[model samples]
Structure formats: C-alpha cells, structure tokens
Target: MPAAPLSILHVVRQFLPNRGGLEDFVANLAREQARLGHRVRVLTLDRLFSAPEMRLPARETLEGIDIERIPFFGSHRYPVAPSVFRHLGDADLVHVHAIDFFFDAFALARPIHRRPMVATTHGGFFHTNAHSRLKKLWFDGPTRMSVRAYEAIVACSDSDARLFQAIAPGTITVIQNGVDLDKFAGAAAPEPRRALLTIGRFARNKRLDRLLATMQALNAEGPDWRLRIVGVPSDITAAALTAEIDRMGLSGAVTLHTGLDAPAVRALIGQSSLFVSASEYEGFGIALIEALSAGLVPVAHPNDAFAWLKERHPLITLADFADADAAAGAIRGAYDRLARGEVTRGEDLSDYRWSGVAARYIAVYKAALAEAGHGVAATAA
Candidate 1:
C-alpha cells in the first residue's frame, strides 16, 4: 500500500508578479509540489505589493493550487492576515515565508492545533536603517517574539542560517535557492563586449550607486561599457542618486528600467557579458545563480553561502568587501581576460533545475514532519 501525500498550506506576506527571488521561489515550490502529487495551497496578503498595478484575484485557483489573498496589517512593509489559521486546519503542514514580516500568522496559529509549522526567515530589518530610534527598537522587539514561534527554521543560505542562529540561537536548516533551468533554455548570451547587467530594488543596501561608480571607472579607462539596471526604484533613493549620474557624466552609460517579467528579466541578463551585484549583504544570491545558469560570469563581494559554488566553478568573480571599486576593476579585467579563452558561457545548467531542488525540499519536508512526531509510512519514506 502507498502512503497518502500530505496536504500543505503555504503563507507568504505578498505575491506580486514583478517581485523577485522569494516570489518566484514560493511559486515554483508550490507548483512543483502539486505536480509531484502533493496537495498544496497558498495564502498571501491582499494589497498590491508595489505602486498601482493589476493585482491577482483575492481568491483563485492556479495550476491546481488554491490561492487566497487576505487583508492584514502591522506596517507598510509587513502585513498579515489572521484568517490564515482558519484555513490551515485542513493542512498537514504550514509553511511561512519571511517569518519576521508575517509574525501575526504565527500568533494566530496555535501549537495546540498540532500541525507542523515551519517558518522560513527570508529577511530581517537588522541591516536596515530605521527612520527613527523608536522604529528601530520596535522592529527588534517584534522580530524576537516571532522567532520564538517556529517548530523549525529555514535559511536559504549558510550566512542566513548563521545570522538566524546568532539571534534565535537554535537549529536552522540551510537550503540554496533554486532556479527553473527550462525557463532559461532558449535565452542566449549576446556577443561578448563592453556590456554588464544587474537587477534589484534601488535601495541603499543594494548599492546600485556602487555599480554605477564601477561603470564610471571602467569607462574612464576607455572600455566604453554600457550598464542596464533592471528593477523597481524607491522614489526617494532615485531622486537622491539621479544627480550622481550627471555629476559623473554617465548619463549615456547607464539605463534603469523600473519593472519586468521573469522571461524578460532573464532575457536581459542572458544578453549581458557579466552579471554584477554590489549588495552590502544578501540572504541568498538568486540573481547571481540565474545569470550563471544563463551563461554569464557573476562578479560580487564574497558571500559565505556562495563560497562552495565559487570553489567548484571558475565562472564567478569575487570583490573585496571594503572596496567595491576594486571588485568592479577586477570584473573589467575579467572581460579583457575572456579573449584568451578564459571565459565560458551557455554552460548546460540542468544541475540547478527546479526538479532537483524540489527533491531536496521534499526531503526537508519529510524530516520536518518527523521532527514534529509524525511518522510517514515506510512506502513514502
């Protein structure tokens, strides 16, 4: 006899189309799990994640998974819906994304219900600057309370796991963010030339200014490279930084596109000679891996979670943390070095495919269930 598949309810803060990384990860995981014969559903916040835009229906079915978007509130940055607990009664497991942001749901979900609840802490405000001292204090207080609710914690990278443990101090599972290889199959890298690319929200932590500075430095040496910055930009940050471009005389060298779909974003990355990241920190470098799978070399400051991949693959370049300028200089130097048959592109990326990733997640799911005192039958095991 075969064992029955577990019914899962996944909770996320929001799921807008243009949101990167976590949105895609959650969507893929939900869809793939359904395809693998598991019952899956999604519950997210109702409000639009960004500026006035078409929102998905408040309640709908997507690829056989039930999706319910509800209105909940804590702050402009983090929202929650208490109604999630009502629907969770039917699920064998409850998976939550960005634990710190959606703590309200955890409070609504009582341990007396006995369903295994796993929380993945995607981001925290510890690294962000609060507008006031009171806001900073309030943020940390809520975060600590949230971390105490989870039966298990998941961190997408080793750095995130270590960081989570430092604050929460408990067992944390580290999982690498995975990409859908098939979606990038037809996308091809353009002829290698003086072109570079990067994507992210235009915030201080993203350090888009550093990438622009790198381009200015490279053009100063006469490589005449062009950079395309594809991402949503915060109005305040954009207003503050636009003058810097004119000051550097890089008006023609840099372009910023506000939003794009997944295919469009991957196509843009595919055509570039290299993918660059100047982030001060990252939970996981999803775009870096996407660019690498699309056959573009990745250059960034060393991130501990990515160290394993870098050691095994020569396709990535690392910059010194103290000076992003040196990192930019090295990337330009890598472009020069490419002509000697040193750079590789369009490498078969089946290894990073979501199917492989789904298998790993299933293993974690089973392990989590076991830890919570659920015994899956031997056949399923």
Candidate 2:
C-alpha cells in the first residue's frame, strides 16, 4: 500500500507574488507537496510594500496549496502573529525558511506545537553590512537558538551548510535548490544578437552595479552588447542605476524590466546570448541553472555556492567581481568564443526538476515524522 500523505506547513517571511528566489522556492515546494497528495499550507507575512500592484487575498489557495497571510505589527520587518502559533498545532510537520527575522518567532513557538520541525537556512549571515552590528548582535542569539530547535536543517549549498554547522553543528542536510527544467529547457536556438541578460532582485547584495560597470567597459571596447536587467528595482537602487547609466552614456545599451511572468522571462532568456550574475553570495544559483537549461552561456563571480556547479561543468566562466577590467574581459572572451562556435551551453539540468526536489522533501518529511513517532496522515481520496 502507498504511504499516507502528511500535513506540511511552511513558515516564511513572505511569499508570492513577492519576486525573489526564496519566495519562488517556497511557492514551488508547497505546490509540489500539494500535488503529491499532501495537505500543504503556507504561513507568511501580509505586506503590501513589496508588490503593491499584485493584490493577493489574505486567505486563499494557489496551485492547490492553502496560503494564509498574517498581518505583521513589528517594525524591523519581523512578523508578530500570535495566531501563527495557534495554526501550528494542526500541522504534522513545520518547515521554516531562513534563520533571521520572523522565523525566530517560529522557533519559540515550535516546542508548543511538539511537531517535527525542519528549517532551511537559505543563505549565510555576517556577509552584509546592511544589518548594523547592534542588530546582528541582537538577532544572532535568537537565530542560533532557533536553528537548534529544528529536527533537521536544510542547507541549499555546501557553503550555506558550513555556516550553519559553525553554530548549530548537527542535523544539516545539503539539498540544492531545484529549477523547473521543462519551463526553461529545449528552447529554440537563440537568435544571434549582441545581448547579455541578468535576472534577480535589484538588491545591494546582488552587485548589479558591478555588472553595469562591466557593461560600460564592454561597450567601450566595441563589442556593443545591450544588457537586459530583469527584476523589480527598489526606488533608491532604480534612481542610482539610472544615474549611473546616464553618467556613463550607456542609456541605449541597458534596459530594466519588472513584473515579468515565467513565460515572459523564459522568452527573454531564449533570445539572449549570455546570462551573468554578480551576486556577492547565493545559497544556490537557481538563475544559473535556468540559464544553463535555456542553453545560454553563463558568467558569474567566483562564489562558493557555484563551486559544485563549476566542478560539474568547467565551462562556466568565473571572474573576479572586485576587478571590473578582469570581469569584463572574461565575459567578452566567453561571448567571442560563443560567436565563434568554440564554446557551448553548460550541461543539462533535468535532474534538478521539481518532481525530484519534491520527492527529496517528502523523504525528509517522513523521516521527521518517524523520528517524532507520529504516523503519517492519510491522503484525501
């Protein structure tokens, strides 16, 4: 007989239609769990500032997963929803994303639920200066404490796992993030165009300003490629980016896009010759996987998250992000090789499909339940 489906609850700072890797990861994982005949629900903050134009119902179902948005009352983007604890009692297992901010509350509430709990630390801490030393000091204790509360901690990459191991030490599982292979793979041959592409949130950590500088250098050297930056830009970053483009006289060579759906994004990638990432860090490079699946040559900074990918496929160009001259040269060399048919797209990533990812999560969920001595719940007929 087939095993019973479990009740899985995911707690995160935010969810779709907030466009970020974490949001997308939770949405896809929840949807996949629901599709696998499990009772899946998402608990998240109800905030409008991020994507005000895309109004979402406070309580609704999407792609078969139940979503509940709790109004946040705290100032530092930390959510304070007492009702979240009340809802926790209904779940067979709870999976929290990220160790900072809102999830500290979830950790405190986990003992009351007495359900098997898992936490996926999406990235490392101590890499950014945006969080003041005092803020980091204040949250650091809770973050470590919360991580220790989990029965299992999922890390998206080796680097992410190492960071968590430094504090919580055990129960770390390295599960790299998955991409939708069908949505990205087997595109019609990319049309010849002097175009470069990068897709991510326009946050300071993404280091897009460095990418802009590289584009400026490349244009000056005569390759004359247009860079398409596809992401929602912050007001401050948008103003800065526009100013830099104008100051560098790259007005005609760069374009910004926001609010693109999946198909639109894939279409854009299919037309571009290269995909670039200048992120200071990543737990896993989902955008890089998407680029490889779409058969676009990828160039990125030498970050540890891409170490596994680089090992598996040696052709991915890694450059020193601190040196624009060197980074631009690497990108130009890759592009010229592509034009000359000397280099090809990276390896196939069909193994990272959502079906396989969901299966891995299900195994972890079953293990968590077994460890807690709870029988898996039956699936609805």
Candidate 3:
C-alpha cells in the first residue's frame, strides 16, 4: 500500500514576480515537491520589494503549486504578515524561507497551527554593515530564540552553516542552492569576447561601483574590455548607477540595464565573455552557478560564500574588487586561461539540481513531521 502524500506550505517574504535567489529557491523547491506527488502551496506578501507600487493577485496557481499572497505592513527589513494563520489549515509541514518575520511569526504560532516547521537561511539580514550592533543583538536574542521552534535549519552555504550553527548548534544542514540551468545553458559565445556580465538586484552591497572601477583598470591595461550590468533597482537606483558609470569615465565601456526578459538576458550572456560580481556578501552565490551553467567563467569577490564556492569549482576565481588593479589582473588571468583552453566551461551540477535539493528539504520535512508526532511516511514518496 502507498503512503498518503504530504501537504507542504512554503512561507516566504516574496515570490516569483520578484526575481532573486531566495525567490528562485522557493519556486523550484515547491515545483519539485509538487512534481514528486506532494501538495505544495506558497504564501508570500502581495507587494514586491523592488516594485512596491505594484500589487499581485491575492491568490493564483502556477506550475501546479497554489500561491497565496497576504498584505504586509512593516518595511522590507521585516514585513509583518500575521494573516498567514488563516491559510495554514491544511498544511502538514510549513517551510519558511529566510530568517525574517515569517520565520519568527510561524515559530510563535506553532502551537496554534500545530504544524511542523523548517527554515532555509537565505543569507540572513547581515548582507550590509548597516547597524551592526543592533543586528547582532537581534540575532543573538530574538533569532536565537525564534530558531528553536524549527525542527531543522537548512543552511544554503557553509558560511551560513557556521553562522546558524553558533546560535543553534547541531541544527543546521548545508544544502547549496540550485540554478535554473535551462535559462542560460550553453548560451555563451563560441569564442569568448572581451565583455563582462553581472546580474542581481541593484542593492548597495552588490558593489557595482567597484565592478566599474575594475573595468576602468582592466581597460587601462589594454584589450578594451566592456561591461554589462543587468538587474532591478532596490536600495540603489538606476540613476545613481548611471551617474557612477559616467563619473568613472566608463560611460562608453559600461552599460546599465534594469528590465529585461530571460531571452534578452540570455542574449547578453551569449554576447559577453565572462560573468563577474563584486558583491560584498552572499548566502550562496546563485549567479556563479548560473554563470557556470552558461559556460562563462566567474570572477567574484572573495566573500565567505564565494570563497566557499571557489573551493568546489576551480574555474571560479576570487578577486579583491576593492583593489581595481588586482581585480583587473585576475580577470586578465582568467581570460588567458580561457584563451588557452586550459579551463573548460560548465560544472555538472547534478547535486544542485532542484530534484536533489527538494529531496534534501523533504527529509527535513519528514523529520519535522515525525518530531511533532505526525504519523507521516519519511520516505520521499
């Protein structure tokens, strides 16, 4: 006799229409969970942080997963959406994405919902150095207290594992993020060019200015390398980025892009030689995975997450983007190696496949359910 399917509920601050690693992670995991014969539903805020003025439908279904959006009140830093309680009726397991309000709220309401809960720490709130003292207090106090409610904590990177492990010992399981390989698979040029690509939110920590400065230094050395920055606006506006480009005398070599469909972005990736990022922090480097999938070499800042990635894949090179000359030299080194055909493009990311990642999460879900005394099958049925 077959076991009954599990009903999984994903509680995230944002979803699909807002593009990012966390959104992609939830979307892929939910889709894979649904595909594996489990019922999956996503509950997110109605507003997109990048496009606050826009409103999404209250409820909808996509890729076989039901999605429900609740209105949030506080700032994006910690949007409060207690209305999620009304939607948890049929869920056997509640999987929270990131360590924000939902993580804490659902933890407090666990007794009411009577559902097992697990959380994926998508690089937590310390991305930037804004208010370090208070952030530490909140993490050591509220976050430490809140995480106790979770049956398991899925850390996306080794760096994240270290952080969460300190507060919640023996609770973390590191599962790296997955890439939508179909989006840019084999989209790179046959012969790499002297162009670069960077994609993500135009947040302050992305350090786009440092990338532009690196481009300036690289150009001064010779080859006339070009840069294409593609992303949506967040804390940093497009106007500000454009001004920085003009100010650095890179108006000619650097290009700024805000909105582009997948095809358009893929086209830019095809035209570019390599993908690069100067982000000061990342919970996990999703862009690097996407770049490797697209057959492009990645030059990134040696943040804890990127450093962790570098150890896994040799084609990924770490550079100090803060020092323009040094970063430029590293980029040149990558170009030389690519030209020599010494390093090939692409990494067999079977381990990062959504099916595998979803399986890992499913184990956590089953453990959580069993811990709560739910007589559910622990198998991946």
Model 1 agreement with the true structure over 1-381: per-residue lDDT tens digits: 126777878887766543666777888888887777788888887665564344567788765667888776666565545666566657877888875455544644456566767777665443344564754565466655666666677887766787678657767877667777666554536567677888777766677767877887778768578888877654234555667777878889887666687778776766677778777666676777777766667777675645655775678788753464687678877787665667766665565677777677677677777877886522232
lDDT: the better of candidates 1 and 3 = 3
Given candidate 3, what's the lDDT at residue 130?
Answer: 97
Local accuracy of candidate 3 as per-residue lDDT tens digits, 219-336: 8866489999998888988998899889888889999987787899899998987889999999898888888889999999999999988888988999999998999999999988
lDDT of 3 at 351: 73
Local distance difference test values of all predictions, in order? 0.69, 0.76, 0.86
Q: In model 3, which runs have C-alpha deviations exceeding 4 angstroms?
A: 221-223
> TM-scores, in order shown?
0.84, 0.91, 0.96
TM-score preference between candidates 2 and 3, better one = 3
Pick out the ten consecutive residues of candidate 2 with the lowest summed lDDT.
47-56
TM-score-based ranking, best first?
Answer: 3, 2, 1
Distance from true location, Cα of 295 in model 2, Å: 0.7
